[model samples]
Target: MRPLPPEALPVIVAARRTAIGTAGHAFKEVTADRLAAPVIQVVARDVACLGVPIDDVVLGNCMGPGGNLARVSALGAGLGEAVPGATVDRQCGSGLAAILMAGQAVASEEMELVIAGGAESASTAPLRAHRESPDTPYERAPFTPAGHPDPDMGAAAEALAAARGVERERQDDYAGASNAKAVAAREAGRFAAEIVEVGGRTEDQRPRLMRPASLSRLPAAFVPGGSVTAGNSSPVSDGAAVVALTSERLRAGAGLPGLRLRGGAVVGCDPALPGWGPVPAVRRLLGRTGVSMEQIAAVEIVEAFAAQTLAVTDALGLDPLGADRERVCADGGALALGHPWGATGAVVVTRLFTRLVRSGAPPGTLGLATAAVGGGLGVAALFEVV
Candidate 1:
C-alpha cells in the first residue's frame, strides 16, 4: 500500500466511551448492545453537532453475539435503519483494527464520515457449546490452529515474564502504580471528558486504592512458580467506545478539534509470545509515518498484564518503571480501568483523544494507541493533535 501524506489521512472529530464496568458485577445484566448503544448515541450526537451525516458504523467485538454487533449497536443507539454497520473480530485487537479500517476508508475517499470503535459485555456473554459437542460447554475456543502452541492468555503472560526476566516485584509495583494513577485521575475528574455514563455509573469500576506492599503478597495466578498474578492482570470488564472519523475538509467546516490519523499498521507474530505482538506493530507504524518515539507525546498501550506491559515498554525503549511509566497510560490503562476484550483497544484511543484534543495539548503533538491480540496479532495507530 502506498503511504498517504499526513494531510490526506482521516481526522477524528469526536470520541466518547461508557464507564467500564466490572465483569459479572456492575454490568452483570447489561448486554453488549446495551453497553455500547449509549456511547454510539453520544458519539453520533456529537457528529450531528458538526452537521455531518454518518456514512458508516464499524465496531469490533470478541465474545458478543456472533451477528453484526455494529448494526445492533447502531439501531439500539437510534442511528436509524438507513445507516449500515459491520463488525470486526480480531480478538483483542478488534477495536483498534476497526478504527484503522475507518481511517483508511475516509482517507481513500470511499467514506466521508465514519464511526469506529469496539464494545464488549463480559458479564453477559453467553456460554459457548460447539456443535460437535453440543452437550459440552467451553469458556473460549482455541486461538491458534493445530500443531501451534496456544497458551492461555494468563499463561502467556507468565511465560513472557519468565523469558524476559521481569521480576515479581516489578510486576506488583506496576500494578500498584496503575491503580494509583487511575485513582488519581478519577478523583481529579480527568476522565470526565471522554467517559459517558452507563448503567448509572460514570466511573471505571476496577481501579482502586492498592498499596504496593499488599499487591506483592498476592499469589501467582497462572503458574505456581511464575510472576503473573490476578492483581497484576486486567480483569474482565464491560464497556464501549466510539470515535468519529472524517475528512480534513469536513473537520475544518465543523470547527471542532481534530486529531489526524497519521498512520497505522497490523502484523502477526508467534502465537507463543502474543504479548510482544505490539512491538512489531508499533515499529511498522512508526516506520510508515517516519514518526519516532521522541516525536510522540503520549501512548496508550493496553495493560493486559504487568509482565507483558513491562516487556513491551522495555522492547520499545520506553520507561516501564516508577513514575516514568505515566508517560504510557498517563491516566490509566486496562489494569486499572478494566479490559472489556474488544472495547479495550477503542478505550485506549479514547484516552489519547482526551489527552491530545480535550486536554488542550499543543498542536501537532503525537499520540499512539496499540494492542496485542490473542491470536498472535498486533495492531497500532498513530495520531497527531490538530
Candidate 2:
C-alpha cells in the first residue's frame, strides 16, 4: 500500500551511515540495543547542522531481545524525551521501511526532520526465543505470527534464483564483482564519507585466547555446498544509517537546503520469483516521475546475493557487464562491506545520498534503492536530486 497523502516536500536533506563492522569481530561486544544509539547518534546528533527539529525516530531491527527497542534506542540517541519513536521490522527491508515511513510522515506534512534508520549487531544479535520453552507461540507472538514475520531472505533468494533460471556460478561472478568494486571503493576512500569510525577492537570479536588464524581459515555460516559462502555472501555486520528529512516549510522557514524525498515505491513479486520485483518498482518510479533508467546516475540494489543482483540487473535490461554496470553500485555493495539485515536498506539509501552529493551530475540525478523481503516481497524506492 502507498504511504498516505502522497505529495509535498518531505525530502531527505542529510543522510549518514556507519562503517559496516565485521560481525562478531568488530562489533562483538556491542549489543543490538546498544549498537543502534551510537551508529544513529553519529549523525542525528547533528540535528543542529540540518537546522530543524527532529520530529521522530523510526528505527528497524531484524531481531532484538525485547519490544520497544525503537523507543529505547531513540532515547539513547539523545532525543528530548518529547520526540516519539517507533520500531519497524521488514526483515532485510526493515531499514528501507524506516526511511519510507519518515518520508511518508514528512510528505504528509505531519512532521519535519524525521530521523529514520536501522541497526543490527548480528554478532551480538540474539534470536527471540526461550530456550527453556522453545515451542511456545506465546513469546514468539510479537515478532513472528503477528508483527514482522516473513520467509527468510536467503531461502527466498535461492528460490528466486532457481525460478528465474539464475546459474550458481554466474551468481558467484556477481559476488566477485561486488567484492572487487567494494575493495576498490574502500581503497579510493569512496566510502570514507559514509562509514564512521567507531572506537573499538575489530568490528567483530574473536575469543581472547583463540588468537591468530591462517589466511584461508574462517568459519562458515549457513550451507556448505553453495556459492553463497561467508566470503561470497554479506558479512554478519554491525552498523546503522540515518536520514534526517525536513519538509519544504521547514527548509524555507529554517533556511536549509532540504533535498526532497520525491516519491519512493515498493513492488512485490511471487515468493518463488521474489527477485523480479525491482524491475516493476523501478519502472513505476520512473514512469511516475517521467524519468528513464538511462537517466539514473547511480542505483543501489541490495546484494542479498550476487545472483539476486545479477538477476535484477538483467531484468532491468541493463547490461550486466560492460559500462552500464559501472554506473550502478559505484560505492560498492553489501557483499564487499557487510549486510546487517534491517540496516541494509538504509545503508543503501545512505550510500545513494552520498553518491548524489558527490556525483558530478546536476541536481535530479535519479537514484534507486531496492531490497528483497521475506515471503515473496520486494521493495524499490527511487529518488532524483532536485
Candidate 3:
C-alpha cells in the first residue's frame, strides 16, 4: 500500500472520558446521552484553540435507546445544530469502530475535524424483546442468526478457556494483578488528567485490591463447573469516551502533540468463540502496517474476561506474567475498571493517548488498542505518537 499524503492523515489531538461507574450505581439515573455529552464537551473544549468547526460527531453504542445517540450527544454538548451525528453498532467493538470510521473520513479529506467515540449506560438500557414475543423479554439481541452457533459471552469465554487449556488459577491470578495495577495507578493519580467529572464523581467505581483467596472462593457464573466467574470478568458499567480527530495539516498548524492513525483492521471468527477475535485482528493490523510487536511501546486490550485476555495474549506470544506485561495495560483494563460495552473500546484508546501522548513518549512511539466483540469479531487499530 502507498503512503497517505500528509494532508490526508488523521490525527487525534485530544481525548477524554467520564469516570466509569458500575451499573445501577452512581450513574443509574443518567441516560447514555447524558453520560456522553460531558465527555464530548470537554474534548471539544480541549481542542477549541484550533478554531475549526466540528464537521460531524460519530459514536458507537450497543444497548442504548434506539435513536441516533451520536447526534443526541452532540446536541447535548451544545455543538450547535449544524454539527451532524452518526451512530455505529458492532457490539463490544463499537467504540473503536467509531474512531476508525472518523479516521477514515478525515483521511478522505472531506472533513477538517470530527468528534468520535462511544458511550454506554448499561444501567438504563431498555428491556429488549422480539416483535413476535413482545410479552417476554430477552437479555440481548442475538449476535448471529439461527443457523450459526452463538453462545452468550460468558458461555463463550468458558468454552474458549476449556478449548485453550486456560485454568482457573491463571485467570484468577491475572485478574488480581490487573486489579492491583489499577488501584496503584489510581492512587498515583495517573488517571486524573484524562478523567472528566460527571455528577461529581471523579473516580472509577470498580478498581480495588483483589486477594487470591477471595477470588478462589467465587463460584462459576456461566456454565456449571466452569472456570469463568464474575471475579475474573468485567462488571457491567456506565461510561463514555470521546476524542477529537483532525487532518494532519490542522495538527501541524496548531503545534499540538497527537496520535496519528496508522492502520486499523476488523475481522470475524467463529461465533462460538468470540473472545479469540482479537488475535487475528491484531495480526492483520500489524501485517498491514508492517509494524512488529517489538516496536509497540504500549498496548491496551479490553479485558472483558481474564480467560479471554489470557488466551489472546498467549496466542499473540505476549507475556502476561513477565516484565513484558507492563507494556500491556500498564494502568489496568476493563477487568478492573468495569466494562461499559460500547465505551470500553474508546476507553482503551483514551488510555493509550494518556500513556503515549500525555506521558510524553517521543514522536513515532507506537501503541495499539484492540477489543474482542461479543459475536466473534475483533477490532484493532495502531497509533503512533506525533
Candidate 4:
C-alpha cells in the first residue's frame, strides 16, 4: 500500500528500442537472444552490484525456436549462470509478464535487487511445430478462439472486432491515432533516450545498420477482411528492454541505480472472448492501489487488437476520442512501431519510466500494460512512478 520512490520507482536507468523493420528484413538474420544482449548490457553496465545480490533475471518472449529462451538470453547476455531465470509465455503478454515478475520480487521483499525486462525478434522468430492430431490439446482448446491460434493475431483481431461490435471505421481511426501519436513522439525525440540501436542483417549489400527508410511507410499485411492491416498491426520485429530494481534500505545505503518495486498483478478471461480481458486486470490493479482512474494522468496499455483497446476503454468508460486517454503512449504504440511479443511489456515500461523521469511530467501518472493470448489468457500490470 506504500508508495514507491523515484529510485524505488523501479528506476529504469537506461532503455533501448530497435527500429521495427518489416518482417524478415534487417533483423531476419539475428536470433532473439543476440538481439536482446545489447539492451540488457546497457541497463546493467552502469550499476554497481559488487556485494549487492542479483535476485534473478526475468525475461519475456512470445516465439522461440526451442525452449527456455529466457534463461538462454540471460546467460547469453553475460549476466552469468549464477543468477536464476524465468521464461514466461503469455502470448503477447510476455514482456509485461517479465516486468510484473521483477516488480513482485522487489515488492514482496523476496529479494532486494533484480533484473527484469523482455525481448522478441518476431521477424526471425520461427513458428512452432503444429499439432499433429485433432486430439492434441493445443489444437482442441480455444483462445477466446477458445484455444486454437488458427488465424494468428491478425485473424484473432478480425474475429474479436466482429464479436465486440467494433466498426471498421473505428478500427481505422484507432490505427490512424497510433500512427499520428508515434509520429509526434518521434518528431519530439521523446524516445531518443530509450530506443537503442539494434543491428541486424543488412540489405542492399551494405555492411552497416542503417535505419530502414521505409520502416514507417511499409504497407499493411492484414486488411483483407476489414480495417485490420499490416500498417495498423504490429510488424514482426526485433527488440528488447531491461530494468534494475533494488530495495529501499539497500538503495539508501548505497549509490546504485535505485528503483523500488510497486505492486503488480495478472488476471484471465474466457479465451474465446479475449476482447474483455483488460477489465478484471485493470480493476484488480486499481483496486489494489486504491487509485481512481480520475487521478491517473496517462496510460500505456498494449493494443493487441483495436477491439481489445476499445473494449478496455469502454469498460473503464474512457472515451478514446476524449482527452483523458490522450496522454497514453505519447510516442506511439504496438500498432505503429511493431509488437516484438515478449519485448512489448518492457518496451512500454521503459518508455513509461522515461515519461515519469522528465520534469513537469504529469502527476499520479499510472503505467499499465496488458496483453491477450490465445484462449482467453490475459495479463496486466499497474505501476506508479513516485
Q: State each model's CA lDDT, in order.
A: 0.89, 0.68, 0.93, 0.63
Could you tell me how far off, in angstroms, the CA of residue 2 lies in candidate 3 after the best superposition?
7.6
What TM-score would each prediction reach against the true structure? Answer: 0.98, 0.84, 0.98, 0.81
Question: What is the descending TM-score order?
Answer: 3, 1, 2, 4
**What is residue 204's positional error in candidate 2, in angstroms?**
11
- Model 2, CA-based lDDT: 0.68
Model 1 scores what on Cα lDDT?
0.89
Give Cα distance to truth, residue 33, candidate 2, Å. 3.4
Ranking by lDDT: 3, 1, 2, 4
> Candidate 1: minimum summed lDDT over ten consecutive residues — where?
318-327
- List model 4 lDDT by residue over 51-109, tens digit each: 56566877888776657776777688787878778777776777777777776667667
Residues 1-386 of candidate 2 have per-residue lDDT tens digits of 24333236476766777667777666677776566676567667555765666778898887666576777887887877888888888777889888888888877678867888888777775555466877753322232344433445555566556666776656655566666666666667677666655655222211111111221233323435433444445656777777777766665565544345656667665655565667777777777766677877778988877667777888787764567667777656887777888788998998887777644456656778888765555777777675
Minimum summed lDDT over a 10-residue window in model 4 is located at 201-210
Over 1-386, each residue of candidate 3 has an lDDT whose tens digit, in order, gives: 13575456799999999999999998999999999999999999999988999999999999999889999999999999999999999999999999999999988888889999999999999998888999889878889999999899999999999999999999999999999999999999999999999999999998999999999999999999999999999999999999999988889999999999998999999899999999999999998888899899899999999999999999988887676679989998999998999889999999999999999999989999999998799999999999
